[model samples]
Each structure stands twice: as C-alpha cells, then as structure tokens.
Target: MLPFTYALRNLFRDPSRLAQTVGGAALVVLLMVSAAALNHGMTQVLSASGSPNNVIIMGAGSEESIERSEVHLEAEAAAATGIDNTATILGTPAVSGEITYQAPIRTESGKEEPALLRGVLPKALLVHTTVRLLEGTFPNSGEVMVGKLAHRKLGIPENEIAVGKTLYFGNVAHKISGTFSAPGTVLESEIWFDRNDLSTLTQRDTLSAIYARLDNPEDFDNAHVFTLLRNDLELSALREDDYYSKLESFYAPIKIMIWLTVSLVAAGAIFGGLNTLYAAFGSRTREMATLQSIGYTRKALLVSLLQESLLATMSGTLIALLIASLFLEGITVPFSVGTFTLTLSPSVLITGLTTGLLLGTLGALPPAIRTLAPKLNKALRS
Candidate 1:
C-alpha cells in the first residue's frame, strides 16, 4: 500500500485544479447547508414551540391560517366546557379565544413590512405558557404588545417606542403599550393587541381561534371531540402538532420553492466538482499507473483516489457547517417552537454533515473510478 501522503500530494499536484474541485464542492455545500438551516429554522419554529396537550380551535374550513376564519361567539362559549377547570390551577378555564390578522407594517426607520398580528384575550397567556413578556408588560385595552421581531423589523427599542404612541394598520393607529416574546414558535414574529380593542378598531364581530390546554396531554382527541360535538359553534378542534402539520402542508409551496432554488444552484456546483475530480484523477494518471506499474494493485490506487475525494468533500462539509453554526446563530424566523428560542439543534447539524458526506461521495467517486481504470496503463506507456 502507498503512503497517505501519496493521495494527498496527487490531489494538490495541480494547485489550480485542486482549488477548482474543492471550491466548487464548498459552494455547493454552503448553499445546501444554508438552505437546510433556513428550512429547519422554519420547521423548528412550530415543532419546537408546539405542545401535545395544547389544542387550537379554529373555524372549520380555515385551512392553515386563522386569518380567514370567523367563529360565532355562542359556539365558542359552548366549546369552553371541554376545559377541565380542575386541571387549570387558577380556577379559570385554561383557554384563550382570539383573533389573528396580517397587516402591512413598517419600522420607525421607515422600512415597510408585513407581519401577522394576534389579538388575544388574557386567558390565552395562561393557556400558552410559552409566551412571556421578556421585556415590558402586556398590552391593555386600546394598547398593543410587540414581539422582539417587531422590535428589529420596526427598528424600535423593546416596547420602547414611546408607550401611548400609535402604530397604524391600514388606517387606524393602535396605541403602543407593551411587548412579549413567545418561545420557539412563530409567535415572536407576531405583535399582539387586546382582542376587544382589535374588534372595536376593525369592527369585527367574531374571534378567529380559541386555544385551550387539556388536563391530559394525551387527551388532545378527547378535547377535540368535546369541541367538535358542540351544537353551537362552527368549530374545528386540532391538536397543536396536527395543526402545525396542516400549516406545514399549507406552506409546502414555500418549502418547495426553497428546495428548488437550492437544487438548481447546487447542481452547477456538483457538476463542477465532478469535473474537478475527473481532471485531478487524470493528472495523476501516470502516478497511479506508476504505482500499479510497481507492486501496488489497481484496486489500491482506486481506494486512494476514493479516499482523496472523501477527504476533500469532508473538508467542504466542515467549512459549510462552521459558517452555519456561527452565522445562523440566533436567526428567529417568523415562526415558533414551544416557548423557547429556535436554536440550531444537533439534528440540523447532523443533517448538514450528512449532506456534505453525500456531496463528497457523489461528486468524487464516478470520475475517480473512470480515471483510475486500466486506461492509466495506456497513459503511462505514452
């Protein structure tokens, strides 16, 4: 068997070609890692913040968004019985009925953005403990609460844009009051206001969703049935996890768009890396031939070439992962995980690493084999 040095030296024997191969693979890996991180960030938003015990009651036929649904008040009242007050320590129903809307908003810096706003009752906070006021107090009637995301996007300090000041959604200016951050879920991207205030401002007559906590985490279906059988409200009960799954399906197009972009971009890099490996192997044809010309077998040379490709691919993977870990540090996308920070978990890192490994193998093997074939003998004889 030849020394490992032999394989390493052959790869960089042509500096320019080596750069081309490694650099191409690096670009491909970088794209995939970043896209994967972003997609995971989104998936993590709901999965991380979602709870098995929590249930979201939305108007039937609302699909993934509550913005489209309008529930009747009496139906909502009837569904309240599903709550086990004994299960709620506070002697109140562990439920929150609220409204969610999408509004075009801008920062104090004059940058316009669109975000979803949730107008929820105080009980909603009790129901969803993941939500907490990280900075200021909760919004009161005629007042509003903004999330940390709104802080950045709106270019305002944490709930410090001068309380009593007004933010316009459409034509009405809702008074600024407090701020809150919900853990891991997409709620951080949301701004909240008093349901009563929102109703008065929009002149809306009904709530969009009713969220509740169950006595048993496993009773999601039981609670769901309790809500579903109500004769009054046109309610649809969904376990939070199941609800988000539907939401993910609803947003499948967006995820597909990201995947498509990554695929198209990565394809070029894959091809470039493949060519680099082929050329690198071709340049080493005589050396590989020399090895085989001596006591070394063709299989050993092939193994060496495979090792080189794998090493290069591994290096690119490490590089991409480093960038993802450091740069993607605290990216809070407009989604939620339970009441926690949407972090880059071990799973995401594993996925990126796996992707890198595949990139190395797929990009390097075929060309390496073709070059290390008996054709090396012909080249050496030349």
Candidate 2:
C-alpha cells in the first residue's frame, strides 16, 4: 500500500481546486445545518410549551387553537371535579379560565401588528406554574403585561414594550404594567390582561379554555371523562403535553418543505461535486496504475483516494460549524403565533458533520472506481 503521506499531500496538490471543493462542501453542509436548526427550533419550542401535570379543557372542534375555542366560565368552577387529584395553592384548587385573542397592536414606531393576547384570571398563575413575572406587577383593567418575546413577535422595539410604556391594542390604549417570562414555553410570546377587562373590550363573554394542574400526571383520564359527561359545554379535555405534541404534527408540512428545499439544492451540489471528483481522480489515473503495479491492491488505493476526499470535506464541515455558530445559532425566527430561537445544539452539529462525511465518501467513490477500471497497461500508458 502507498504511504498515507501520499493521500494527504494530494489534497493540496492543487490549491485552487482544493479550496473550491472545500467551499462547495461547506455550503452544502451549511444548508443542512440551517434545515436541521430550523426544524429543531420549531419542534423544541412546541414540545417545551406544555407540562405533563397540566390539563386543558377547550371547546370541542377547537382543539388545535385556543383562540377559536369557547368554554363557559362555569367550566372553571367545575375544574376540580373534572380532574382527579387536582393541585391546590393556598387551599384553593389550581384552575383558571382563560380567553385568547389576536389583537392589532400599535408599536412605539406607530407600526401595527397582530399579537396573541391572552386574558386570564388570577388562578392562571397557579395553573401555569411555568410563568414568572420578571418586572412590575400583573395587569389590571385597561392595563396589560407583555411576555419576554412579545416585542419580537410584534416586530416592536424592546424599549417600546417595557413597563410603563403604552401600547394600543384596538382603540384602547393599554399601559404595560409588567413583563413576564416562561422560558421554552409559547406563553412567553403573548400579552396578558384581566379576563373580565378583555371580555368587555373584545365583546366575548365566553372563556377560551379552562386550565388545571393535577397532582398526578396520569389523571388525564378523569379530565376526559368529565368532558364527556358535560355534553352541554361541548368540551374536549387533553393533557397539556399531548396537546403541544399535536402542534409538532400540525407543522409537519413546514418541516417537510424545509427539507425538500435542502434536498433540491444539495442534489445540485452533489452532482457538481461528483463531476469535480471525476476530473480530479481521472487526472491521477497513471499514478494509481503505477501504485497498482508496485503490488498495492485496488482497495488500498481506494482508501487513499477516500482519505484525501474526506480530509477536504471534513475541513469544510468544521468551517460550516464555525459559521453556523457565529451567524445561524440563536437566530430569532418569528411566526404567526410566536418566535423561536434557532439553536445549533450538539445533535444538529453531529447531523451536519455526518452529511458532510457521507457526501465526501459517496461523491468520491464512483469516480475513483471508474478511474481504476482500465487495464493496468492502458492506465499506465494514458
């Protein structure tokens, strides 16, 4: 077999070609990282938004969207019976009546955007234990509390959404009374107000959903059974975690579309890479023939060629990871409901590297095989 030095030196034999191949591989890897990061960010956000011990009872036919659901205020009163082993705070059952609305909000710059506005009774604080007030006090009538990511979702500057700032939602000017955070939860992208006040303003008397915390996470069956018995309310009960899992399915198509785009572009890159490999290996036909004549087997020569290709591609993979860390990681992607920060976590990094290695191996093999196909005499002569 030839010395490993031969394969290593061959990688840099043509500096310009090496750079081009590495750059192309880096681009393809970057595309892969982008797709994986996007999917990861979105799916993680949804999956993290729910708690296993929480239960949601929303109007039937509106399981996918709380804003479209309507549960009577009476449902909140019956929450304790609806869920077995309901959690309690200060001797009161942890239950909340909530109303959700998408309202047009005017930013400080006078630009208006739609923001998800959730109206909740005080008990919501106990039921949604993930939420914590970051500053100031909860909202009163004619006042509102903004979530940490609400400004980004609304396309407003951070200063404009701070406590004491005034934001116009519809014709009513609601003062920003506080800021709240529920890290890794969708609630961090909504505005909160008093339940009665929002109902008055939105002209909706019905609550959107009833939320309750249960002592045992497995008590969801009791909630479901309760919902079935209350035929008058036409409500459906779901475990909060299970409900959020459904959101992943709801966005399944978007994930598919992202990968579809990457597949198309990567296919072009793979073909271009294959052509490059063919030309590069084809140029070394006589050299490989000489090695074969020196008692080196075809398999050994193939390993040498692969080592060279992998070295270039792996370098590109490292470069792609660095680029992703600097630019793509933690990028905020806003959607209709909220925003999620793109993360280049370990799994995502591994995926990018795996793709690069596969590309290098597959791209080089066919051309390398074809180059070694000719008779030893003919290859040496060529």
Candidate 3:
C-alpha cells in the first residue's frame, strides 16, 4: 500500500495538471450538486407548506395551479363547514377559505408577466401562519397585494404600491392595494383580491378553488369522499402538506434533467480524472520499474495508484461542497411547487459527497490498473 502522504503528494507533483483537473472537476461537481439542491429545494417548499392537520380543496383535476380549478360557491360552503375551529391561528377558525387564480400585470419597469392572484378574507393572514404582512397593509377593494416574486419578476413595488394601481387583465382592470407574504407558498406567486372582485374580472362569478385549514391531518380521511360526493361539487380535498407534495411532483422533469446533466458532466469528469492519474503514473514508469526490480509487489503498486486517484478526487469533492455551501446559501430562485419555497436541503449535500467518492473510485481504477500491469522481464536490457 502507498503511504498516504505519498498519494497526496503525487496529485500536486504537477501543479498545472492538478489545477486543471481539480478546477474542472470542481466546476462539474458544483453544477451537479447545485442542480440536485435546487431539485430538493422544490420538494422542501411544498413539503413545508402544511402541517399534519391542514387540508386543501381544489377542482378534481387541478394539479399544479389551483387557479385552474373552478368550484361552485355551495361546494365551497360545504367544505367551509368542515373546518376544525380548534387549530385556527390566533384562536380564529382553523380554516381560512380562499379563492385562487392568476392575472396578467405589467411591471413598473420590466416586461409584462402574469401574477398569480388569490382572494381571501382578512383572517387568511391569521389562519395561514406562514403568511404575514412583510410591509404595508392588507389589500382592500380596488387595491392589490403583491408577492416578493411579483415585484421582482414584474418590477412592481409593494410599499409605494398604491390602493388604486390598476392591473389590466383580459378586458378588465383590477386595482392594487397592499402586500403580504405566504412565503415559500403558492401564494407567493399570486396577487390577492376580494373573491367577488376576481369573479368580476374573469366573469366566472365563482371561486376557482377553496383552501382550508384543519386542526389535525387525520381530519381529512373521509373528507375527500365527502367533497367528491356532491355531484355538483366536482371538488377534491387533500391535506395541505400532501397537496403541495403533489405539486412538487409536477417539477419531476427538472429533477430528471439535473441527474441527466450531472451524469453527462461527471462522465467527462471521470475521463479527466483518469487522464490525470494516467499522466501521473506514465511520467513515473521508470520509478515503477525500479520498484519492481527492488521486489515491490505489482499488487501494491496497483493499490498505490488507486489510492492516489481516490485522494485527488476526494480532495476535489470536498472543495466542490465547500464552495457550494458558502456561495449558494440562502439563494432562492423563483419556482412554483404548488406554494412551496424550494431551497436546498441537507439530503442534497450528502448526495453530492457520495457522488464525489463514487466518481473517484470509478474514475481511478482503469488507468491505475493499466499503469501497474507491465512486465518485469522486458526492460532490464532496454
């Protein structure tokens, strides 16, 4: 077996190659790890949206956006009756019924982007614990509420956002009022309005979907069948946590892409790693020959080369993870998983480290074996 120091030193023997190999591997690992984190972040946002006791009621087929679900007022009324008044935030009713939809709004600065719009009673603030007025006041009629994202993507202002800023939709103009946050939620993607106001703009005169809060998640066991029973309802109920989980599933393609990209880049990285180790050994064959002549076992030589490869790749992995942690912290890219605020989770960190080690072994073995396999008899005369 190689001395640990000996393996470590070999990687730096050629400073230029070490830099090239480590830097390239760092870039590949950084991207792969970050992408994995983003994918996990999406899942986290959705998962965090609800506790065990809360539930959501939406149109039968409306998966990603509750905006697309259109339920009648009576169906909403029945669900509202089922609220577990006990768990309500601040002693209010547990259920904060809301109407959710979307509208097109132009920014004060950037290009036009559609803002997700929601309508809720004042108690929605009290009911959804995660929601609060980050600044300004709650919305009023002809007034609008904006998400942090709405301001960023559409360049709208929330503080200076007026009570009468008109958001022009299809043929209607809705007013802006105040700002609030249901951060890390589907609500962050939306603008709030009076449900009646939404009905006026879209002319549906009914809610798209109704969201409910419950005291315990178990309250939902029979609720789905109940919601589905009304022939006229065409609505389904789910635990708020579960409802968001379903939404995260919509982003499965993004996760797949992350794996696909990392797999491809890491494949190239494996080659680069192999090439680096190959060169390290190729330049030292004379030394190897001498060692063989001195009675060192070929098996030990093989182990040494493999050890060196592991050292270089593991070093590269640690560097990648450190850089990822320090640089990528608290960064939230706007993505919608129902209402989740997707951010990297600890699980993703572990995944990156595991990949690095695996890449090290797979990347190192081939070249190590090739370099250590030569004959003892041919070289003495040469």
Compute the lDDT for candidate 1: 0.70
Error of 3 at 310 (Å): 3.3
For each candidate, the alpha-carbon lDDT, in order, equals 0.70, 0.89, 0.66
TM-score of each: 0.87, 0.96, 0.84
Give the worst 10-residue stretch by lDDT in candidate 3: 335-344
Full-model lDDT, candidate 3:
0.66
Backbone clash pairs for candidate 2 read none
lDDT of 2 by residue, 305-358 (tens): 999999999999999999999999777788766889999888899999999999
Which candidate has the highest TM-score of all? Answer: 2
Q: Using lDDT as the measure, what is the rank order of every candidate, best first?
A: 2, 1, 3
User: Could you give candidate 1's per-residue lDDT for residues 1-382 as a string of tens digits?
Assistant: 6688877876677777766666666677777766766777676665755677788888877747678888776655565665443147457777778888776765444545566778877777877778887655688776677765665444455444445556776655667776566666667667788888777766899988877787777777666676567746667777877777776676678878988998998887887777767766777677777877678877787777777777777777777767766777675444322122334577767766777788776766787677677565596974
Model 3: residues with Cα > 4 Å off, grouped in runs: 60-65, 82-92, 152-177, 336-344, 379-382
Worst 10 residues of 1 by lDDT: 333-342
Candidate 3's residue-wise lDDT over 205-262, tens digit each? 6666666666556667556767756657777776777666766677788789878987
> Which rank order by TM-score, best down to worst?
2, 1, 3
Candidate 2 residue runs with Cα over 4 Å from true position? 80-83
Task: Please give the lDDT score at residue 163 for candidate 1.
Answer: 53
